[model samples]
Target: MGTGAVYLTLSNLKNHPDFLTKVEIVFFCLNIILFVTNSTILLLQLVLFRQQFVRLVLDPVKGVFVPLIVLSFATIIIGIINYLVVPGHLTFEFVYVAFWIYIAFALMVCIPMLMIWFNSSHDIKTFTPAWAFLVFPLMLVGIVAINVLRVFPLLDPRAINVLLVGYIFQGLGFFVTFFYLTLYILRVMTTGFLEGHQANGAFVACGPPGFTALALIKLGEASRVILPQFGLVSETAGEVFYATAVMGSLMLLGLALFFFVFGVIPYWFKVHKHLNEILGCWALTFPNVGFVVTFRALGDVFQSQLFWTAHAVFTYSICALFVILFSLTIFAIVRGEVLFAKEKDLWADIMPEEQKRLTDNAASFGTDTVSTLDIVHLGGRKLSVDGFSEVDLEKGERRPYANI
Candidate 1:
């Protein structure tokens, strides 16, 4: 099926004039290579690290990594379909699938990252929010899959509502978690301490700005679904296309500005505070390039050279950064202790008292100091302890350090 599709894409490319087409067989060849590389890595991980993958990834209640793989596969399928079905137009089918593939690529990163984040061999049973964050992108993936497949009639109509609920909740999940991430960064910053590189990896793994940009784009699409109710526009394909394009273009612009000004710049300056700071710094590297390509849609619509040139630069730059970032992350992961120990020690510094208190308590109470407290509950409760209790106080004798 894939071979037939590739053949069709080649046939379509042959008809277009040499000057009219910027995309070549080489582009498809490169894409195939990337796909194979990612697929091979995933297969190897599932085989060699099956136990670790199950413990660190598949066993989680949220099931983030599997959803991510499903999403990536869906995006790849959709992109291949788009290339075959509508090779000329930069319309919804094309945009939808292309962005999704990039999303998959970004999330594919989290697989190995999750492995590294959960590398503590002491107790495989213990879990952390860092693990939860590692799987967050999968939530978005399930959401997008439902939305697109339903809209495109690739899925059953009865399932549409389920998909919508998935979309809404998935979106809300990202929204709620993102606030905590922001709070986390703020806490680290205010304390004049840095989080472990893995913690920073977990933060970038949450994919705040990228998800927001996608959310905004989705919101614009949702607007098109209800456009005719206002009676301000016709319910025609051309009209829908134009409106979605215009709205998406504007939202993309706003998101690009927000990403660069609010997200990228701040992150770049504070890169030292993060352990895998490069991941956070480079997370937007691909998504922002997609945003730039969205801008190039103007030329695609008009069938002109203007958009094509912009695409060339956007494609090249993003591809370069992707290669560089992937190389750096792989090196860092393999180097493990040497590369990350210094940064992991940074997280140790931030809450030294908390960690120490936990350690002391663990020795006494039989609990680790690194307990996970839900942020909401922490906000609501307030308690103060005067001092430790006496071991034997029946005669009203108090131990100095035991009770006060």
Candidate 2:
């Protein structure tokens, strides 16, 4: 819950109101709750698995959110440092470093899983926002952790080292995200909007670019502040990064809007009449969060009334939408309604005959079907049921053969 979306809500609510306003305090408290909740969820998963926590790292799809879980923890620590901790307090600074190490460990585990998922996982046509799972961790340091360092007035070597590492990850994330995004677009060109639950993957496009833009802007800001002390001189660094951020924000905003009109809007039109299983598309929450931050950052850069208006609109719009969706999600979870996709739910886009053939052929049947509809769903929560062999839900991905 403390995903970028949570921070986006907190960012908007906190900034728009006077500090200590009731609304700001509510969001502030909400942020704390969200952080603890996400942490609890992760800890529970680890405890449930016990010694086999190692296997979680090997999981391609579910492992994607591992980074998120870690990043969320990092956000909580830094948020405490930035907003709550006593000013000039060094005691909690070690806590910040601890979370930093935590994220580093998570990246060590999840980054490899991300690469393995892309290269080894089968099915391409159903690709969705799952691709962006790799992008967020790359931005975590530049977007969240670095500010915590700034709280202490970090030295150049330490700060530049941090910035360089984040820059490298962001660049790598961009390459992979762009590569898959090209394939995603081409798939749409050939097959058209991803069918069924997978259609939500389109909104995934909205996040990485905006995230990259914001990350780059932060990198630039850090560079201007810290690089000069290292005898690094680049008069154009700030302008270059800021201009890139403005242009990138607009580009991403256009892309997100395009996906919304063409991808999400059509789904809404039908949803009123037919209540289809809407699952992973809820991922749309965080990308809009990304856009809100993107717009606000760009607005600050250009002092553009237009960006500010967009920012304000998104700020309120996202907060309201987050309230609706987050509530619905929690209600579903509490009621034991299935939140993660079964193979069938995700692979509805797969040719029905093909899915049935796979299902029918598997005689050593289990309760849950296999859906190899596409690459792993983002966050790795959506189990494959389309083309993969039968998944024993009770067993959780104990497939003998990945039929691909």
Candidate 3:
């Protein structure tokens, strides 16, 4: 999704003389390859490892990320519209149908996953801004709508419907994200920043408002064109909507900035030490892409050289961040740390013998043997070491340790 966002943002610069079409093409192909490879692996996991897949979906710490599956597809759709349909290389009719199809897929996946999270028990102290991912796909609807709207006349019925639905989606996504963010603030105030690499999740908070701002501005641009032709109210109603959208988007951009700063402060203090243990490090990429895209939108809205310069600087910064994170991810994989690490918490419910087998397999692959105590500690479970015994912090009882 992050790569696709970078590609889409660069593709939007087609009118700029310095825009390199080949760079955009490289990113487009890279995005497609990464998306397909990841999707295939996930699909295989679902098919061949159904039990483990179910466990993963129900695991408290990891389950929140399930929505990213749908969100990834949303990026693909946006990329297709912008890179293919907008260029007239692909017919609008195909992407138009794809738009609705993706909407249905996002709703079906995100809604049910949200309900699952609601029905399941979760400790509030374990909450992180990563929960914002649940609504990310829907938030992207407005972006998809704008891209789709580009191929149609401002007065076309199809464009009008897309515009109206975009507003609905934007509202749903933004307000729900607002609610989660409120809880995130409460969680942080009560529990402090999530420890270790998990602190990277804080950056996830920047994504919602950033994308919401981008969507609002783009949708507002659409309204400026479409609403005036419909005779819905005064001829200036479109202008009013556009003005209101700019104000709302600016407010959202401020909120996103707050999160971006909030996420950065921990890094400044050196709170997160394990930078490459998990793929979550990439959280730094997509969220900031939204921020940069919003900056670009404001640049376009005002034609301000300052805003455009800020946008360019940040865009290059994000590109550098992506490269750094990508290199770390590959190194971690080679070291048998991230994808190959057998996280016991994820298999806490497995049979003891099966758990041992997986643990040994991981160790055979040169992965370090991480104790259950370490895994539990990382997960923030209420357990503490008391000499040779393990004490349950919640119950204040010592239990014999089992090495498995």
lDDT of 2 at 54: 51
Q: Give the clashing pairs for model 1.
A: 197-275, 197-276, 358-369, 388-402
lDDT of 2 by residue, 1-404 (tens): 32335544555432454553455446556767777886676587566634234555656555555666555554556555645553555554564566458557657756676676667665566556665666566555555544555564556366566667767766776666777678777887777666665665567676666666667666666666665556665756645655665576567666656655666665653332212333464566665565666666677777777877777776666667767776666766766564453554434444557556554433235434444443234223233444644344323444644542
TM-score of 2: 0.69
Superposed on all Cα atoms, model 1 deviates from the true structure by an RMSD in Å of 14.3
- Sorting all predicted structures by lDDT, with the top scorer first, yields 3, 2, 1
Q: Supply candidate 3's per-residue lDDT for 93.
A: 80
Colliding pairs, model 3: none
Relative to the unseen true structure, what is the Cα RMSD of model 2? Answer: 10.8
Global Cα lDDT for candidate 2:
0.58
Per-residue alpha-carbon lDDT of model 1 for 1-404, expressed as tens digits?
A: 12112222232331346642334344445556656776787687567646444553545433433444443443344445445435554444553554356455645666665565446442322222244445455445533443354345323342333334445545665665555455545544555333333223322323444444444444344434533434334666335644664565555455445534444333444446422455443443433433454434444455767655655555555556555666776766775722343433333233446545543543353322332132113331111122553211112233444333
Q: Compared to the true structure, candidate 1 yields what TM-score?
A: 0.44
- Per-prediction TM-score: 0.44, 0.69, 0.82
lDDT of all predictions: 0.44, 0.58, 0.75
